[model samples]
Every structure is written in C-alpha cells, then in structure tokens.
Target: MNLEEKLKQLPNDAGVYQYFDKDGHLLYIGKAKVLKNRVKSYFKFTPKLLPADKLSPRIYKMITEVESLEWIVVPNEHDALILENSLIKQLKPKYNILLRDDKTYPYIYINLNEDFPRLEITRKVLKEKNIKYFGPYSIGARDMLDSIYEIVPLVQKKSCIKGKEACLFHQINKCHAPCEGKITKEDYAKLVDEALGFIYNKNKLVTKLNSKMEEYSADFRFEEAMKLRDRIKSIKKSQIQTGMDLATNENLDLFAIKAINNKAVLVRMFFRDGKLASSNHNYIKQNKDDINIDINEAYSRAIVNYYDNELPLLPSEILIADEIEEKRDIEEFIKQKFSKSISILNPKRGKKKEIIQVAHNNCDELLRLQNTSSETSLYEDLKLLFNLEKTPNRFECFDNSHMMGQATVGAMVTWEEKFVKSDFRHYNLEAKDEYAQMRETLMRRVESFEKNPAPDMWVIDGGETLLKLARDIRDSCGVNLDIVAIAKEKLDFKAHRAKGSAKDIIFYERAGEILKLELLPSDKRLQFIQRLRDEAHRFAITFHKKQKRKEDTQISLLQIKGIGEAKVKKLLLYFGTFDNIKNANLKELKEILNEKDAMLLLNYFKNLEG
Candidate 1:
C-alpha cells in the first residue's frame, strides 16, 4: 500500500493513525484529530522538493512495508493523544521517541507514628498510613538537598556522632548534640516541630524564629541569639518567591495561554492551602477551526471542556487564561458546581500579574525544551491527546479467557502510573462464547467497581467489537466508565497460498469466538490481542486446572469399595499414589487400608478396577 492508496482510505475527521513495518511492528504513532487535514499537510504541494529531517527517514521506513491502515475516531485532538499513548505502549512501535522512566519521585517524610518522627527521605506517600511526606521532590537539586540538611541542626537535632563526644559541629556551636544525651529526647522531639514548621509552613517558621531570637537576646544569650539570626537570614535568602499571600481559605489555579505555529500552550500554576503547590504546561496541536477562533473563544472552550471532564479540584480562587465574556455566568456556574464563590482573576498589574508572568516564563522554557530536543513528557502528551480531565495516574485493563467453551474466566490487571498492581483480580468467567465471556467478565468487573471504582480508564483487550461489548456490559450493570480495546492489527502483506488463501489475513464477524485472534499464519492483531488475552487465559487456566486436578485425584480414590474415607486417605498418603489400592495385593492392601476394608478393596479392584 503506497501513499496514494493509503491516502484515499484515510478519514476526514479528527483522530489518530498508526504505521507498522513488515515484521508487523509499530514504527510511528501520531495523532491528527482531522484525519485528511493532518495527513495532507505532510506531503508538499509545491513543485520544489523539501529536505527530510530525523523523523523523515523513520517515517520513510514505516511506509515501505505499509500493508495495512488502522484508525480510531475520537471526539477531539486531546482525545487523540490519550489514544496515541495507549496504542504506543500497547504496540511499542520501533520508531516513536518513547519516554523511558516511569519511576516515582522520592519524597522527604516524617513518621507521625513515632514520638519524635524522624526526618528521612522516602518515595511513597499514603493517607491511610500515619506519616507525612513533604514532597515528590527532585533528588538532583543540590541547593534543595542542602536546605534540608541545614534545617536539621537549626531544629536542634544532635549531630555529635549520635551527639556523643563534642564534634566539630558542636564545637562550632551550631549543633545541639542531642545524640550524646546533651539534650533530652523530649526536647529533641520539640525541635522536630520547628523543622516541620519550617519545611511545611515556612512563613510561620520565620515568625517563630524571630520570636525565639528575641527571647534568647533578652536572656543575655547573645551567642545563641546570633546563631538563630543567621539561620533566619539564610532561609530568607534561599527561598524563591512563588507569588501570592492569600488566606487559608484561598487555593488558586492560574492558567495562561500562548499560541504559536498553529499550536497552543497552556500554563497552569497551582496554589494549595495559600501557597504554591505545583505547576504544569500543556501543548495542543490546533486544527483549522481552532486556528480561526480568537484567543478568548478558544480559552472559553478549553476551560469549559477541561472543567467538564476534570472538575479540577476547584479552590476558592482561580486565574483565567483570558477573560471570558460570560464571567458572571461562569461564576454562577462554578457556584452551582462547587457550592463556593470562585474569584476569577485577570491580573493586569501588581503581584498577581507577577505570578502570571512567572507561569508564562515556565511555559516558554518548556516550549524551548521541546523544540531543542526530541524528548516529550508523557503526562503532558497524554493529557492533550485524551482530552483527559487529568493525566491518568491509574489504569485497569480487562480481558476474557476460555478453552473453546470450557473453564472460562476474566482478568483485571491494574497499572498505577506505570507499574502493575498484580494483586487486583483473576476472575472466573461464567459466560459462554466470546461475547458472553466478555459480558460476564465485565459484569463481575463492574460489580467490584460498584463498591469501589478507582481507575482513570478501563482498557479492553479486543478490537472494536470487544470494545463495544465491554461498554454494553457496563451499561447493563449501570456502571459508567471510559473504555477502549487494543485489537490485533490486520496483516495485508503476507503471500497467497496455492489455493489463493492469504497467509496473513484475519477476519471477524463483529462478535465471534476469538479462536484465531492471533493464532493464525500471521495476524498483526493476533500479536496485540495474544499478549493481553493469553495472560488472562493463563491465569484462568491455572485456576481451573488446579481445581480440576484436585477434584480428579479425590474422585479417583473414592471409587474404592468398603475402603471408607479414612482408609482411602491413609492409603493414598502412605503410598503417595492415586492407583496404589488398585495395584496392591491383599497383604499390602491390608497393611495400608483397614484389614476388613483391604479385603473389600482387593475384591473391588479384582472385580471392577482397571
């Protein structure tokens, strides 16, 4: 299939398309909500030819063995990105620049369970657990690490080799040497409050620090007072001002829009509990309609769509990308949605504008970062592609399994961020055939979810047919969820046989047994489906096989007449055999089985056992 032939079949609507190589490997994955519009832009209409870059050679290779085309039609461009990443990982195409690390960032934690919670760094944070973590902070920043170190001594924590004999730090009068028992455990624990107060509540810490300094000076402890003063000065100098000093009731999110080259970038700054929490930047490749729309209209559409899906944890205040003409209406809308008065700001000057400027600067930095390098953040791209309210942190995949028509089962595998949580479930599929198996699998899945639903997306392991099947089950069970199927890619390049039967072709009658899903001479969809389906099948088969084997062994021994449960169990355990009674002579049977039962067993074996 050449470009002309492929172009003729491509759709005009906005969606995503993928390219595969001859080995049936995905080579390039991309999204263009407008199918024809995006594809046409790739080819030059001018008489003069253009030079190709790094992506050019890769795409050229992908087109070479292009035997088939596949596409997914979604609501918009953002949804396209979400779909793109889902496919990219599902297919792991050879050419797309993939993000490698999926590790969670380490955080600084204080265990609340201890009388004196120790200050240590950790990676995980849980609300149910009795501990508090300060950050998912960067491990590489030297200054940040130094700041954490500095707080240790100022909080009066002992540094004297467990605070034993006077160390250099104690000699320098900077350490309290609590480890040497110079300070009592209770006093040291009190110091923990100061350290936590500093890291978690910097403003309050500064105020408390100044008060402590003044009190020390008044008591004629000039040396101690001076040390306190110096520490306060250092903290002030190191702190980077993230705009705003709002009250505790106000948590704000500010969004700013910047567009260039037919793409729009949105910058978001988050303020939680009256302080800057975190920030993010997103880029959206625009269609012609978006390009023609003014900034305000685009902003309105984007914000409304964003909130509709995400309902971002609305704070008391918000900052807008552009002033919506329906500000009153938006306020009323938010009030109805959140039951709180939300103040939307378009800061023209002062600290508010400064905060907005800071957000804009970060956006520009991110844009430069992307332009200069091929690397892209998966979180940003996924959010843009899926039009997801937020980046998917948790996802669950479902697949059904059966052997022809027996021992059917379903399985749910979960991926939090990127790591699999294998303990979730291996369901026993109770329904028959492909459709019923899927239905039963999803019904059980939704039932679990009805009690506790906690996934951003539920991925199915079949194509369009199974995708719809999963949804229908969810509907019947009154469970609402977003789902998609990762089907086998059709193979159109394999050679024809003597009878003209193509070796690579795969067919589906919408909903039928997945007997040959990927078990054919060569089917692209087969590879994709088998990975997920086989896993589900393996889990199901393991469960059923264990049960079958247990039952079979038990029934085999039960056939012995007059043996009774006790004698039959003993003979099996003593001989470690299932056919021991049938083979044993009368004397050997008498020793293992009961004396009277042994004769009956011998008679039964002689009479009927084979």
Candidate 2:
C-alpha cells in the first residue's frame, strides 16, 4: 500500500513508528502515545502527502525522504518507549541521535567468600554472593588497588595461601602469612578492615601513603619512596574534584547535556556518600545533513542507554541539569527493572542544583575545547582535499592479514573523532589470495548496510587495483560511499615496509578518472589516513594471530578418532580452552559429547600423557 493509504489505517493506541525512504532505508524511529496523531503530525494532507510547515529542519528533511511508514502497536506508552529505544539501537536509523558509548568503567571488588579475600579490579559485575564493590572508577582503579595492597598487611596473592608456606611477601613484611597459620583469622580480618577503610576513604589512604613515603625516604629507600609518591599522585589525579559536598551523605548521579550547533556533550558525575567519586563524558555529533538538535531527545537517549544493562550501578537519586519530557517514564523504567524506587529530579535551586551545575560546567568546557581543537578542522581539510560533498566525520578503514594463505582474516576499524573500538569488526576470510579476500570482506560489509548504514568514505589499504575493487563493490550495492586507498612507496617494484623513508601514495576518483596524489610526509591529512590504515592493519594482524592459535588448538584435537572440526568446535565452546579440555573428566566430556566420543577423547589424552 502507498504511504498515504497506510497512514489512514493507523491505530489510535500507543506504539512505535518507523519511516523508510524510497530506497528502503530507515530514516527515523519514534514513539508516541497516540500513533495516529503522532504519525500524522509530520505530514499535511492537502489531498497529497506533504511535510508539515511547522516541522523543524531536521524533521522536515526526514519527512521529505520518508516514502513508507511502519508501526508496532503496544499496550501503553511505557512499552512503546522501550520498544522505540531498542529498535533505534538495533537499526540505527539515519536521523536518530544514537548513544554509541559502550564503555564499562572499572570497579574494585572483593569476594568475602574466601578465608583471606584479596581486592581486585573488574569491569563487569560478578554473579557471586558476599562480594563488596566500590567506585566505578574511570581511572586509577589499578593504582588504587595496588596502593591498598602496599599499605595494608593483607594477603598479597591468591596463590600465597595455596602454597601452605611462608613466601617472599611474608619475609618482606608485606603479608601476615596466613598460609602457615602465622596470623589468626581475627588478625587477618582486621587487616581486611583496614583495606576496606582505604577504599571507603580516599583522603585517609593518601595521607597514610604520604606518611609511608616519608618514612621510606628517611630510611634511605629512595625507590620505594618514589613509587609511593607516584601512587599518591595518581590517586589524587583520578579523583573528580567537586568542592561543594551535599553534606547529607546522599548518594546520587548527576547528568548534564550541552549542545553547540550540531555537537553535544553528556557529562555524568557519580557521587557516593555525598562526594564526587568519578566522572565520565561522551561527545555526540549529528550527521552532516542533520542540523536541528533536540536536547530532550539527547537526554532521554543518554539516560536509557547508560542504564540498559543487566546489573547497572544505580544511585539513590538522579539529578539532571534540565527537566526531560520522559522523566516519569525513565523513573518507572528504573523502578521496574531494578525493583527499587529512585527519584529523577531537576532541581531548581539549592545543593542539588549546585552539584548539577558542576556537571553542566564540565559539559560546557568539554564542548568548548572540542570545538576549538584541530580534530574538527582536520575533517574540513579532508573534505576539501578529497573533493567530497560532506565532511568525513565517520569512516571505516579496511586491511587484510594472512601468512601464505594460512589463517587469513580481514579487519575494519571505525574512526569517529577517535577509534571506536566497539564498532571495529574482524572477518575470517576463506579466500586464499589477497584480491579475493578483499572482495569477500567488502561484500560481507556491504550486505550488512541495511542494518549499519554506509559511512561517509571508505579507506582501503592497497594500491589502485584494490581501490577500484572497493569502488566497484560499493557501486554494485547501490551505496553512495566515497572510496580511497593508501599504498606504501615501492622500491625495486616491491612495496617497501620501511618506517621513516617510505612516502605513501593515495588514490581516489575525482571525475570518472583515478587520480594519484603524493603529499608531503608532514601533511596532517596524509597522516590521518595513515593512522586509520595502521589501525586497520594492527587489528587484522591481531585477529590473524588469534585465528592461527585457534587453528593450532583444533589441529591437536582433530587427531582424536571421533573428533572432527564440528566436534572440536563444540568441545572448545564447552570447555573454553584446550587446557580445560585436557583436564576435563570423563563425565564432563560426556556432558558435551556422546559417551563413545567422550571415552575416545579421554583415552587419547591418557595415551598422549603415557
């Protein structure tokens, strides 16, 4: 059915709607309480479908491109909100502001289940009981953990207790020697308590370290003193300084968003016990065609994406710089997901507002620094250099690595202001030759364009032939993406790999003709492309080595009588590693495979050992 005809059949219930262009590419996804009213608001009937006059520039552009409409009817607005967010993240519509930050901050945790628990750092929450976690520290988590061990006379290593004898740590007075019964359980508990005190109070820890450093200096132990001094510096530097404390010991999380032109920044400050513990910030940039910025939508997306995890570290109260339209919906989401009630507040005045102002100030300063930085100008120079229609704010670089057709792999790394490690991808290619491997990789990527739309440009790590190959692939897919390739300088008709002397050449199409350009080594544009190519090369090589190792493991397992590639794969998946498989008992092997195959594998291991 036509878009207009479909619009007439819209339901009145709450749901999410998606708009697609004539080319069958999604333009936007949105949720509304009344699907019919919200879907119709973007258009003016006038006997024909046309964009509404009062729409923002961004929405008007989206409406003009939208040729089809799709919707999912839900029971209520809450369901609609959740479904919309999920679809937006999965589909990544062209006109939506996606929160691409998938970083997990570090946390210092201790599992009290052990007799002598040792502090450790982890990025993910463990599914174990009697575990105490502290400070989702963005930095200095490792240094802080080390400082705790250095100061407190706790067990230094997990293996120390298993040895059943005094180790070097005990000799040096760093550990209380709980393994040999040198320290009682109560005495060890006191030491653990001292470590916990340091984790709770940063100032006390630094003061104690300072005192230790002075004592070491007075005893002519300069190296130990210097190490302690560095640790103290790191801990202090990692701390987020918010001079004004709320004075009420209330744990809260503050969010502030600020936008200038098409760029925005989201600053999050985490406070524990009414003091700032750590802060994180993410920069959000709109697509080149998108001019209108929606602060409310940005705020909603940031909050939703941050808390969209299995076990998020939620705060008692969330303070925001500005009131969002979906405040109640978010609050309800948190309560339902975590089964804990929390407040989402926009403080007009007082301590809450002041703390939020600190977040706002951070956002403003980050935006200002980013705006004035050379990175923004570099993209402009790139656009002019390549004769592109729009700035190449986001692009992907491709490289392939192999060893004589063995363990061949291709990698694509994304660069958007920085290397987006989360978006980077690796492909194990079956093709033996370089050209075929490149073709297979590019074809796979092009097939995924429906979900992840094409970037502004593609940087290929090859000469003219491979550059043309990338262009042909994009053209066959009907994707309007620019393509460029960088090739190292050739010496004696062979590509040179020397670092300093080689002058790489760049190839691109300008007007139906391939053009080669060799800029000076000092040019930033050339350096930028080189950096992208280098990152792609590094990623591909790393994947190739990993594939080689896995194949080596598979080769050893494939020697078993009943173990083929599929069975080996299944065994590896269940056991995790070859060492684990070697140590698995007959019962454990039977759980993954049949009794016959499990017995064969067990006998093979026994025979090998014999």
Candidate 3:
C-alpha cells in the first residue's frame, strides 16, 4: 500500500509505528495509545501530505525524508511501550537515541554459604542463594575491598582455606590462621560482620581509615599511612555528596537529562535511606542535524532501558527532571514487570525538586565538559581525514598475539569516547598464520552481529593484507562496516616494534581503492589509532600468556608419576599459582593430593631445581 493509504488504515488501538525512508531503512519508532491520532499528527492532509506546522525541526526533517509508514497494533499502551523498546534495540533506527552505556558496575559480595567467606568483587549477579551484595559501585569497589582486608583479620585469599595450613599472610597477622584452626568460625564471622559494617556505612569507614592513618603516621610507618589515606579518599569519592539529604529516610532513583547541540547526557543518582548512595552518567549522541530533538522521548527511553535489566534493588520511587508525556505508560510497564508499586514523580517544588535540580546541574556540567574535551575535535579530524560518512562514535579494533604460532589469540577492543572495557573481547584462535587469525576473528565477530551489533568502524593492527582480509570477511557476512588498519614502519620486510622511534602508517579503503596515509608522529589522529592498537595488542598478549601458562603447567604436572588432571587441578587450586606450588613443601602438596602423589610431585620439582 502507498504511504497515504497505509496512514488511513491506522487502527485506534494502542500500538507501535515505524517510519522508513525511500531505501527501506528505518528512520524512527514510536509507541502510542491511539495509533491513528499519533501517526496522523505528524502530517496534515490539507489536500496534499505535509509536515505539521507545530513539529520540531528534527522531526520535520525526519518527516520530509519519511517515504513510508508502518504500525503494529497491540493490546494496550504497556505492550506498545515494550514492543517499541524491543524493536528500537533490535533495529537501531536512525532517529532513535541509543544508550551506549552497557557497562555493568562492580559490586562487593560475600558468599555466606561458606563457613569463612572472603569478600570479593564481581560485575555479575552470582547464582548463590546465601549471599549479600553491597553497592553496585561505579568506583572504589577495589579500594574498599582492599581496605577491608587491611583492617580486618579474615581469610586473606581464596586458596588459603584449601591449603589446610598457615601461609605468609597468617604469619604477618593479616589473617588469623583460620586454615590451621587458629581462629574459630564464630570469630571469623565477627570479622565478616565488621567488614560488612564498612560497606554499609561509608562515613564510618572513612573515619576509621583516618584514625588508622593517624596511627600509622605516628608510628613512623609513613608508607602505610599514605596507602590508607589514598583508600579513604577513594571511598569518599564514591559517595555523591548532594548536600541535600531528604531527612525522611526515603529511597528514590533520580534521573535528569540535558541536551544541547545534538548531545544529551543522562545523570542517574540512587538515594537509599535518604542519602545519595551512588550515581552514574551516560552520553547520548543524537543524529547530526537533530539538535532540537524531543526531550520527553529521551527521558522515556532512558528510564525504560535502564530498568529493563534485572536490578538487585528497586527504589520506592523514581524522580525525573522533566514531566515526560509517557510517564504513566512507563509506571504501568514497571508495575507489570517488577510487580512492585512505585511512583515516578516530576516535582515542581520542595526537597524533591532540589534533588532533581542537582541531577540536572550534573548533566549540564557533564555536557559542558564533553563539549570542551579534545575528543570532539579529534573525532572531527578523524572524520575529515578518512572522509567518513559520519563522525565515528564507536570503534572496534582488532589485534593478534602469539609466540611463534603457539597459544594464538585475537583481541578486539571497543572505544566510544573512552575504552569501553565491558565490550572488549578476546578469542582463542587455532589459525596459525597472521592473515588467517585476523580473518577468523573478524568472521567470528561478524557472525555475532545479531547479539552484539557491528560498530561504526573496525581498526585492525596490521598492514594492507590484514586490512583487506577484515573488509572481505565483513563483506562476506553482508555487512557494510568501515575498516582501517595501522601498522608499524617496516625495515627490510620486518616490522619495527620499538616505541617512540618507529613510524606508523594507516590504511583505509576509499572509493574501492586502498589509500595509505603516513602522518607525522605528533598527529592526534595517529596517536588515537595507536592507543586503540596498543590496547588490542595488550589484551591479546595477556590472554595468550595465560593460555600458554596453563598449557605449560598442565604438561609439566602431567609428566609427574602419580599426578593426573584432577590432582594437578587440586594442587593449582590450593597454591593459586605454579610458582607457589613449586615453592610449596611436601605438606602443602599432601593437603591437596595423596601423600604418595605429593612426594612424587615434590621430587619432580626438586630434581628440576638441581
């Protein structure tokens, strides 16, 4: 059907509508209570189809390009909201504001199932029933865990208990020798409770650290004092000091969005027991010409996309900076999904308004800082240099690391304003040659495009051959992705690996021709590409070293007369590292394996040393 006829057939029931251009590319998606009114409001008949007079410049431009319309009728607005989010994520329409921040924050957790559990940090939700999780901290989780270990006498390491004997940690008094039954389980529980108090009360933890710092300084332990001082600063920095406590012990999640020049920043703050616990911010880059986009839609998508995850805790209420048009729909969706009654409020006055103002100010400051950063100019330079279709917001770089074709591995690192560590991936490749390894890595990545969509560009760490290989792999997968490769200057067909003195060349395909450009070492664009290539190299090498180490350990231990895979694994688990196992006496080995097997292992190690 034609666009006009399809518009006329729109149903009155709630549903999602999609706009497409002449080339059949999705332009936008929207959910509405009445598909007919909402879809018709974008255009006026007036004898001929035209954009409505009250439409924003952004939407007006979109309407001018929209050549077709489609709608899916749903049972109600709640389903419409859900379907809209799902389609936008899967399709990634042009006009939609996609939140690129998929990072999982760290949480300090304790598995209570163990008799003497050690505190550890995790980015994912564990499947343990008897567990307690602390904050989903944006920063300072490691520092906090370290400080707890420094202050309390708990199990110092995971392998400590399995050792079934005291180690250096117990001798140094960092642990209570729980492995040797020097400390009772009840006493260890007290230490665990003390550590929990530090996680629960940030202020108390800071105060205690300060006292310890003072004590250390007075005893001439300046180094120890300085370390404690740094930890205290880190823990304090994690807490958002809003300066305006609700004083009512109310819990809420505050969301504030600010946009300017097609750049939007969403600031989210979590308040628990009337105190600001943690906060996070995300940057949303809109279409190039979409400066005056709708803020209400941005707010709606942000709230829905964030809460879509299985959160560890849900606040009693949600506060937003603006009164979005789809507030009621979001609340209903949340109620249905979470089975919890919560209010989403946009306050006009009082403490709630003040809190929202704080978040808004944060968003504004973040946007301002982003505008002034060198990354903006760097992106513009890169786009012009490469003659790219648009400023590349997201980049995925690939590199291969191996030792004479042994322990081959490939790594892909992501960059969006910063190194997106969560999206970085490493692959163990069986392909021995460099070209084959690069091809395999790119192929595997392209195959998973449905789950993890392709980035705007691919940066490879090789010369023209590997670059073309990447392009061929991507094309074979029927995906149109930009690719560039950086390689070190070659001397007599050998790559110069020296840093600072070696020059680098960048190659990109333009108009079906391979173009090689050699920029000065001082060029910011060159430095940017170098950073990405180096990170990919570092990641791949790290993984390769780990694989190589594991292989070496397996081969060496399996050669021992009474040791097999199971016994080797037990020894490694107890000692944590191969070096530790080598230094371990017969007693430590016996703790993990049979006495005879332990003797055999000890003799093998001793003979090697001799």
Score every model by TM-score: 0.38, 0.78, 0.82
Local distance difference test, each candidate: 0.55, 0.84, 0.84
Poorly placed runs, candidate 2 (over 4 Å)? 22-24, 46-48, 74-76, 206-239, 287-292, 384-398, 406-522, 539-576, 581-610
Which of the two candidates, 1 or 3, achieves a greater lDDT against the reference?
Answer: 3
Q: How many clashes in each candidate? A: 21, 0, 0
Candidate 2's TM-score: 0.78
**Tens digit per residue, CA lDDT, model 3, 455-515:** 7789999999988888778656544357899998899899886776788999998877889
State in Å the error of residue 378, model 3.
Answer: 1.2
For model 3 the TM-score comes to: 0.82
Ranking of all predicted structures according to lDDT, beginning with the best and ending with the worst? 2, 3, 1
